[model samples]
Target: MNHELSLDLVQSSVLAGVLLILGEFARRRVGFLQRFSIPGPVIGGFLFALLLLVLRQADVATVEFDTTLQEPAMIAFFTTVGLTGSLSLVRKGGRLLIVYLLACWTLAVVQNLVGIGLAEVLGVNPLLGIMAGAVSLEGGHGAAAAFGPTAEAMGAEGATAVAVASATFGLVAGSVLGGPLAGWLMKRGKVRVPTLVTASTGSTTTVVDQGSDTGSDSGSDTGRGPETENAEESGSAGYRKLLSTGVLVGVIMVLGTLLGTWFSDTTGFVLPGYVGAMVVAVVFRNLNDRFGWVRLDSGTVDLISGLTLGFFLTMAMMSLKIWELYALALPLVVILAVQVLVLVVFVAFVVFRLLGGNYDAATMAAGMMGHGLGGTPNAMANMDAFNSRFGVRSERAFLVVPLAGAVLIDLVGLPWIVWCMNWVG
Candidate 1:
């Protein structure tokens, strides 16, 4: 008999940390992985998951993890994403964000249509097709899991299994595809990020080269190192900022809960749990930006957001149950192959053109592919990786991609899935 080892919440969190550390080491040494900018957590998480699968398969050991931290981590990470959106950034990226969001909704509609239409052609039940479509693909495991019971209730046998398997394929495929897609688009189009050029005619130009990771130079980098140093020296002030910002984030999350609950309860329009918190954070950020009510540093907020995102993804990926994917793999491959072809064409012809045929657009296209195929974390990893290697930080892509993929698409996508179910039923 195989030994069964079940970890509690604390142990699971620690394991996730270990996986991230190991993943980082692998990413540093792996040539192809480094060239593409694959995130450390993804590398580590997948490796750990595969290890679990292997152990279980061999009947040497079976491990169970308490995944209680996963959802809260996701919610917290997304809330930080909302914090990234100041009113100024919004004003600059508003049109692009809106357009990208609309494109996602359209894509969701198309995904369902393709899945359902092809399922009919193949003589599979259309209800089963819906599970394979946006539910599993664009929505990932969470959405698939959410819709699974409903589909089963509607008479689709083994709906949950099908959804989980399809989503697993999508997660891996999306991760592999995103970095390559963006790289290809940028290379083929000969797109390059615009470099800042100043006409230095006897004018003192202070050049501080901040590394590629943080995008543009901050105030400290612009010959203001003294001010930055002074700020750093003020230990009390730094502590106050940290405490205040932490408290504010907590307050915003609480407010978001109340607002999200009210929005869902009062109106029939249900939203994902994190959306409300994120929207509230956005409001707070914009308010702070405009009125200077509280000094919220963009750099600080970004640091916190990055931390949350890393931990969230680490915990989430470490809990992957891979063995369950094998049984439903065959049918999904054909269905998903068709889905991928559509994504390629759609991204090349439609998404690229409409968003703009520039480097930022290419990065955004890659991000869209990530979220469209996998989920939000995949999208972020793709964009982050592309940006890390190439220094193409499209603020518009960062703001729009997560909100659309994580929250906005779900609004219409879920309804559309159910409608397809009702139509077929």
Candidate 2:
């Protein structure tokens, strides 16, 4: 007998929350997963997905989810990312950002080339390779979905399944790869971690410090205490600023949607809506930074973003169509294996060398592995894992990698990936 259960949007969200709780518990209990820096959602969501597969195979039950909240969760998560795009933070990374962006663009090109080449070797469509490459790997699931329609329209069978599967593979691979690779680089290079090493430079000030810079009327002056600003911003004034920032974020999202639609309609080249939101968000953040416009609190922004990202990942993992992976599974596995080899070589040699070939470079290597392999969070998890043991100051890496992944990749890299997709299709 087969049972079918359909859940409403709220119920599905509640189920997602349950999955996240279970995921967190698993992270705490599973030593191997903990040691390797496996994200809680990845474990829990994948497990659930596997269970779904087993049930389907057994003819036990079919579960249907109203995933209405997933897209909004995605948008909200990215919006929080956008809030962090202060020009000041961008300025902090300076040339490092420029080089990393170039490296990422180069990586995109190489991924496409490698993917397309593998398709040829396997006697498949080049478009399949492109979808599996930057479109899925670097672009993650969002880009995969965006590009999937076009691929299907162009006669690529099971395009969506391949893209999603590859991205899922990337998340796990990226997480596993980053920590160990960083550890090797640190051990081999004899890199110094700031936590372990003395602060030879004058101030031990951090982004959090600059973030609290609410009191200073001028950019040169330092920010006030976060607590002080928190206290002051709590009254009517704070509430007002909070509302204003939220409104602005909403407006940015709407505008981004419009812009992306316009571009896709007019240019015949497509982009994600979040790209527009982030671009506008960065502009707003910088303007607010300079003009004291409605007192943006970094802590608040982080809180909103963190919650959204957590939910977004949970939904993303839970919704994986793991059963669809059987088509071209052998070839897809080979393609992914080659992509890993390429990523390892690039991170081990190219990334480490370009960023100064020092301790900072090593830390950034770990961080880049996070975003490079999956997304920004994996990069943080990788950096966090490496930092926990080695005691390195990865502040710059934390700032730079996320910025590049969230903003630059969409702006600079997406176009190239789309052009390739269109060309191949």
Superposition TM-score, candidate 2 onto the true structure? 0.75
lDDT of 2 at 358: 74
TM values, all candidates:
0.66, 0.75
- Each prediction's Cα lDDT score? 0.74, 0.74
lDDT of 1: 0.74
Residue 266 displacement in candidate 2 (angstroms):
2.2
Candidate 2 positional error at 131, Å: 4.6
List, residue by residue over 50-80, the lDDT tens digit for candidate 1.
7888888899898888868765655665566
